[model samples]
Target: MRTQVAIIGGGPSGLLLSQLLYTKGIDSVVLERRSRDYVLSRIRAGVLETGFVDLMKQAGVADRMEREGFVHDGTQIAFDGEMFRIDFKKLIGKTVMVYGQTEVTRDLYDARDAAGGTVLHECSAVNPRDLDTDAPYVTFLKDGQVHRLDCDFVAGCDGFHGPSRQAIPTDIRREYERTYPFGWLGILSETPPVDDELIYANSERGFALCSMRNDNLSRYYIQCDLSDTPDDWTDDAFWDELKRRIPDEAADKLVTGPSIEKSIAPLRSFVCEPMRWGRLFLAGDAAHIVPPTGAKGLNTAASDIHYLFEGFDRHYNDGDSDALDRYSEKALARIWKTQRFSWWMTTQLHRFPDQTEFDLKVQQAELAFLRDNEAAQKALAESYTGMPY
Candidate 1:
């Protein structure tokens, strides 16, 4: 098989990139290690930065999103049993969309299918070969048979554990990672949200976030020990812990229901410098991962896709390789800033195992500064809504 680009993942990043490229008459093939059902089954972050929403629009998959996704003009921050709102629209003149990552993947998959794009699910042992050369190709196993796909370039949107990043020689690939001591124990429930907008709370026990997929489906999370597992907490126990971390007002109105999905996700900030390796370009989790505190996991991935698509457009249509040449630098520049924001948010809200009384006071002081100072709020709002592309 031959294609202009061989995408080594069928997640939102890979699917979005392929769909976006298709609009420009670029052809690509997406390979997924799991079945389509498995891919869509994973629940992820729901917040969408303005930049990601625009990318969805550009990819021609915004019909459902614009119709169903809620527009969040601001978010709430709670500390010391009190809550304050940060008006993103008022401070930064922009807003974020509350759309599930699952929905985003579904829309991209639908668009890809409608366009008759090639998306090979259950493709295993995927490997990108000769990435440093002009003739790059990908090989994978399917149905007990091995298939090779020749392409002009390879897109490593296969995520953190995928083969794309591993294909880069260790001598050339530089990886940086910081794993948090805690994890987020999240649950999805069919109940109205506790608040109109998302609430990020820092309490004496831990950090909690109240987010929603729609008006009816709520997603909530509370900080937990890394040793904890989903099976350790019952539905009632999870709700009780969450209520303890949020403000009394929200807790009073909080609706409890049977949890539809539950999981514990470890927080980490990881980045692989130089997202591009010759004809192979890494996008999304293959290049970097942020702690979910600032909701940059998918948003940063969209930014990478944005840059990679621009590079491809310039190379194929305008015959300019400048963007392609600087893909790693440009993508990394934006990614590091995002990592910083996510790290700062996580540090501010989460209670570390080693946190002292002084440390707690510092976190309180920082939150207080953000609550009282307009400049600080504006800065938080800018990062929360997203930095410019």
Candidate 2:
């Protein structure tokens, strides 16, 4: 179908873009390869920056979230069995809300349905052509039938592995990547959290995080070998590893139950530029992906969409292409800053088994100094909660 924008991938980026454009009197359709249930029920990260909450509220989708989501003023960093809290209010005058990505997607899905918006699931996109050229269409396979969709512009929010990037001419794209030696073994448990605030712990074993989704559910992650898979660890093994990494004074407090979900996420920092080519634009994972250590993935995607909508507004309403032309450079500035922060946090917290004793001691000393130094603590707080964007 013809529309103002043809959005690929109905994840947070694509869906949110459609909603934002819809409110601006623009028409768009979202194409998703997964069912609504899969997107809604999937256990994803659960931290929302203050700006993110403001955007959602302005979009008129924060009613249920305001009631159901948990708000936290700060997070704790623990090492050597000692905990240091960074007060977000004192640091940035903002607090983050603990709300899972699943809930946000579900709310957006319901909003789209109620607004009579289209979200095509289980439809695989083959090749999306350029709008500047003669062929401006998206080819997809649906119901065992190949269909061609013509649209005014395309928004490639399909993620890092999706076909949207493959549609780009290789020579025009410059890709930058850095893969970490370790990955995260993430798990969701039915047990309540061991602590009220999220904890980032550094120990001899590795890095461990204790976070909660709600009163009844908890989420945890531990550093694992990059090549490790979900099947590599049993439930007991997982708990043992977690205990070794997570420092706890209360022996029986960090309790866990049957894991509802388990997955291995490889750590990587990547960026593909420029984010625009001809009439096609890219946002979210389609454009860049930062390591999850800083919890900037979803928030970055939302910021990308915000800037994109501004560009679209300038182009369509004011007949100004300046914002569209500068979108990539503008977005990438915030992107690389976050990428460095995430990488810094990752390196500081996670221990590499191959490192010498001297290296380990250096890292430990750095952490210890940062814990006591107000300047360093303020720096971490600024990066963790975001500076302005």
Candidate 3:
């Protein structure tokens, strides 16, 4: 089959791009490696940057999100036995939406279904070929048969482990990565959050975060050794560790419950240079990854899609090739800034195994400066809320 654009992944990034292009009357096809049920079952970051929220609305998929999502004007930061609030609204006159990534994907899927967009699931061996040429295509296996999709352009939205990134010839591709020595052990429970807004804590024990999905679905995380797994800690042990890492005020009010879900995620930052390789363009996890500290995982993906969609919209609708040509330059500019913020947040909040007495003191002093200085607080708020797209 032939299409204007062939998207390699049906996740939020690819679906959002397809939906946006559809609004412009452009035709595209999305191929997902897993079933829709499997995709929606995965849990991911919930914090939504302002730019991401706007993109959802532009795609006409924000009806459910805006109705069900919570607007967080600020977040709480705790250090040295105390917690303080960083008023994003007060500092930058902006706010972030607290809507789960799973919900966002669901909304996008529903929109795709309603629009009768082509989204093939459980397809294997999805490979984009002739990416450097004017005409590129993807080949995959499904139902014990091979199929080819020809397109004017291909979108490599298939994530880090997917085949999309490797399709770029090694001679032209550049990669940078950093894997943390620790991981985050998180649990989801049907209990009220310790506070109304999310709380980020840095204690002598480790870093912990208090977040919520809704009024009753609370999410909490604690820094752990990379070797540790979910089986190493019981629900009660997880709660106790979390309480110790946060402030006494939040810990005292924290409600304990049986964990509905549990998992451990290793922290890592990855980036691939030049998101665009000729007729093939990369978006979301295919192009970059940020540690969840700054909550930029999905938000960064949204920014990439924003840039990619702009390129597609301008080229297909306005007959402008300049925007499409500058896709990588434009996307990476914002991506690096996001990576720096995530790295900084991770360094500031988490305890490193190699941290010396001096290193601990430096972290404390940095947090103290952020708390005392209005200008520093403004910088954090601006970054945490998100930079302009």
Candidate 4:
């Protein structure tokens, strides 16, 4: 079937893009390789930046968020037994919400269905081409048959491994990547959260971030070897490490219940230049990825959708191609900033097991500087809150 736009990937980016286009009286078809259930259940980096909250409110998906999402004014940075709060409001002129990406996905999925947008699941995109013809076409495989879909435009929200980005010739795109030596072993506990504001602690053992999905559900992460799996750390080992990482005063109050779930994720930063090529535009993880330390993944995806639709409006409705032409450079400006922040945060907090004594001391000193300097604190808060589009 023909459409105004064909969105690849059913993640937040593709779903949100379709919803936004529908608001503007445009029709788009979203193709997702995974089932709706899988997408709904997938856990992600939970913190939502300030700009993302604004977008959700604008899209009318914030009702549940308003009712359920936890709001925090700041996060605490603890090092050497001293805790200093980085008041997000005081630092960035805004505060963030502790909301999971799963909730956002569910909210947007329901909104898309309510708006009568099509989301094709369990359907793989074999190849997507930006036919230079007057009408661009995207061909995909669904139900064991190749379907050729003609469209006014295509959105490559499919992610880093998806086929959309490969449509651009390797010569035209420059790829940048950095892989961290450590990963986060996250856990969801049955007990209440240890504190209200999130705690990012730098300790002799390693790094630990104390956060929550809700008052009853706590989400915590500890630095681990990149090769470490959930099986490597027993429940007792996990609690012991957690207790050591948390400050002495906070340790007694921090309760460790049976871990409801556990998972390990390696840290990395990735970006591909020029987010758009001809009729195909890349958004979200399809275009770039940031380490989870900065908590910018979901927010970056939201910004990408906004910019993609803005470009779509200029190109399709206003008879102007300027926005469409500059979409890549425009989005990457924020993408790289977050990449730097995530990388910096990762390095400042996590103790690389492989690093020398001098390097470890340097990491400690950097954390100390962040705590003592107002300008540096403001920089962290600003990026954590998000940079404007």
What TM-score fits each model? 0.99, 0.95, 0.99, 0.96
Better of 1 and 4 by lDDT: 1
Q: What TM-score quantifies how close candidate 2 is to the native fold?
A: 0.95
Runs off by more than 4 Å, candidate 3: none
Q: Write the per-residue lDDT of candidate 3 for residues 1-389, one digit (tens) a residue.
A: 99999999989999999999999999999999999999999998999999999999999999998899999999999999998889999999999999999999999999999999999999999989998888888999999999999999999999998898899989999999999999999999999989999999999999999999999999999999999989999998999899899988999999999999999999999999978888988899998988899899899999989988998899989999898899899999999999999999999999999999999999999999999999999999999999998
Please provide, for model 1 over 1-389, each residue's C-alpha lDDT reduced to its tens digit, 9 standing for 90 to 100: 99999999999999999999999989999999999999999999989999999999899999999999999999999999999999999998999999999999999999999999999999998989999888999989999999999999999999999998898899999999999999999999999999999999999999999999998899999999999999999999999999999999999999999999999999999999778888999999998989999899999999999999999999999999899899899999999999999999999999999999999999999999999999999999999888998
Every model's Cα RMSD, please?
0.7, 1.7, 0.7, 1.5
Residue 156 lDDT, candidate 1, scale 0-100: 95
Write down the lDDT that model 2 would get: 0.83
Better of 2 and 4 by lDDT: 4
Off by over 4 Å in 4: 131-133
Better by TM-score, candidate 4 or 3:
3
Candidate 3 lDDT for residue 321: 84
When summed lDDT is taken over every stretch of 10 residues in candidate 4, the lowest stretch is 125-134
